[model samples]
Target chain A: DVKVTQSSRYLVKRTGEKVFLECVQDMDHENMFWYRQDPGLGLRLIYFSYDVKMKEKGDIPEGYSVSREKKERFSLILESASTNQTSMYLCASSSPPGQGSSYNEQFFGPGTRLTVL
Target chain B: LAKTTQPISMDSYEGQEVNITCSHNNIATNDYITWYQQFPSQGPRFIIQGYKTKVTNEVASLFIPADRKSSTLSLPRVSLSDTAVYYCLASSSGGYQKVTFGTGTKLQVIP
Candidate 1:
């Protein structure tokens, strides 16, 4: 079974402070993604990486950035946190593109709820 | 990415089959249909998907007919634990594809 794990399950930080959320997948998947879930709005993609050191912006990537220094780990960074940024952050991973069914199925971590005060 | 539309919520009883439908009117030819189930306070999990016709897995079934204007997810003998938000995802194939999740159908299974 593939497992995607997040570093923090819950976090609280003051405004203007920098925050980092990490995700690691054991399956050696090539695709990793970060998303934020808000009420009524549903899950919005923040960033995604198809390979190590390669990243792309999703629909909502203004305040967030991502890093993929390794194949099994992906990291999301908030340069300056704010109150409105308080929401659940989710990390996901999938098999490499061109691999079977990777375009659809992505394994997810439990989620990290970050509250930017 | 095709925009999907689904019911806001649904009600069903135990031992009953629940069919939650999602509509994607402008689905592209190469796009594959996917559904995900998300419990409160957790990340969404993959359920079932299909291009056309019926595709059934142990967790649920996906039925997509010709023309692919819509699809239905059938959950048999739903239990209380089965209650969650089911999201219909459609991703366009060819080139760099982007996936957008719908509002999702909130299925509340009752005993």
Candidate 2:
């Protein structure tokens, strides 16, 4: 079985403070993603890394960035945390997509609920 | 990536089968349908994936027709633990296309 773990389950930070949320996967998957889930708006992607040192912006990438220094670890950085940033953050990892196969199933971690005061 | 639409919520009883349907009228030829289940305060878990016809796994089954415009996820039996949000996503293999998740269907399994 694949295991994806996050650094924190709950976090609280004051406004204008910088925050870091970490995620790790044991499956050595090539793709890693970060998303923030809010009520009614659903899950919105923040950033994704397809390989080491390679990152791409998702739908909602403002005020957030990501790091993939190694294959097993992916980190999400919040430059200036605000009250609006309080939400559940989720991390997921998956193997590279095949040429013609529809096997891009992503395995997710338990998620971290971050609260900005 | 294709847009998917599903119900907001559903109700079911224990020992009863639950089926959730998702519609993707503009699904492309290479797009595939996948379902994920998310419990409260937890990440979404992969349930099943299928392109056409039917595909069954140990946990659930996916049924798709010839047109592939929609898909149905069938849960054999329901339990209290089965209550969660089910998200249906449409994705294709190729470039780096970000997967979009809709509001999803919330299933409340009552005893």
Candidate 3:
């Protein structure tokens, strides 16, 4: 089975602090994504990486940044954490890009609940 | 990018079939329709995906019309545990880029 593991299940950060959320997948998938889920707003994509050292901004990428230094690891960074950034962050991995014989089904991790105070 | 719209909520009883429809008026020819089911505080799970007419799997089914502007997700013999939010996504690989969760249809199963 493919396993996507997030570094933290919950985290609390002070305002203006630098925050890092790490995600690692055991399977060597090429596509990885970060999304923050908020009530009413639903799940908004933050960033996605199709290959190592390659990244693309998603719908809500203003306050967030992502890194894909290696194929098995992807990281989401908050340059200056704000209170509004508090939400449930989910990490997911998919097979090679455009290879969603089933429309790019993403296998997700449990998620990290971050609270910016 | 094509935009998707779905109902806010729905109600259904156990053992009944539930169908949730989503509208994507600007869908392109190559766009693929996908459905996801999300539980509270958890990430959404992929249910089904269809490009043309009908696609069925062990969990759910997807129905797309010839116009490709709308799609329906049908759940067979839904149980109480099946209560969750269903999201409709339309993507055409590259052109249809943005993926928005625009108010997915939340299904509440009643006993």
Per-model DockQ against the true two-chain complex:
0.60, 0.70, 0.57
lDDT (tens digit, per residue) of candidate 2 on B12-42 = 9999999999999999887889999999988
Candidate 1 ranges with C-alpha deviation above 4 Å: A101-103, B92-96
Q: Of the candidates numbered 1 and 2, which has the greater lDDT value? A: 2
**Per-residue alpha-carbon lDDT of model 1 for A1-117, expressed as tens digits?**
779999999999999999999999998787789988888988899999988999999989998988899999999999999898999999988774456664547889999999887
The runs of at least 3 residues in candidate 2 whose Cα sits more than 4 Å from the true structure, single-residue gaps closed, are A99-102
Predicted structure with the largest DockQ when compared to the true one: 2
Scanning candidate 1 chain A in windows of ten residues, the lowest lDDT window is A95-104
| CA shift of A63, model 2, Å | 1.0
Residue B25 of model 3 has an lDDT of: 96
- Among incorrect, acceptable, medium and high, the docking class of model 2 is medium
Q: Which of 1 and 3 is ahead in TM-score?
A: 1
Which candidate number maximizes lDDT? Answer: 2
- Of candidate 1 chain B, the 10-residue stretch with the lowest lDDT total is B91-100
Alpha-carbon shift of residue B79 in model 3 (angstroms): 0.7
Fnat for the candidates in order: 0.54, 0.70, 0.58
Comparing 1 and 2 on DockQ, the stronger one: 2
Model 1, residue A14: distance off in Å is 0.5
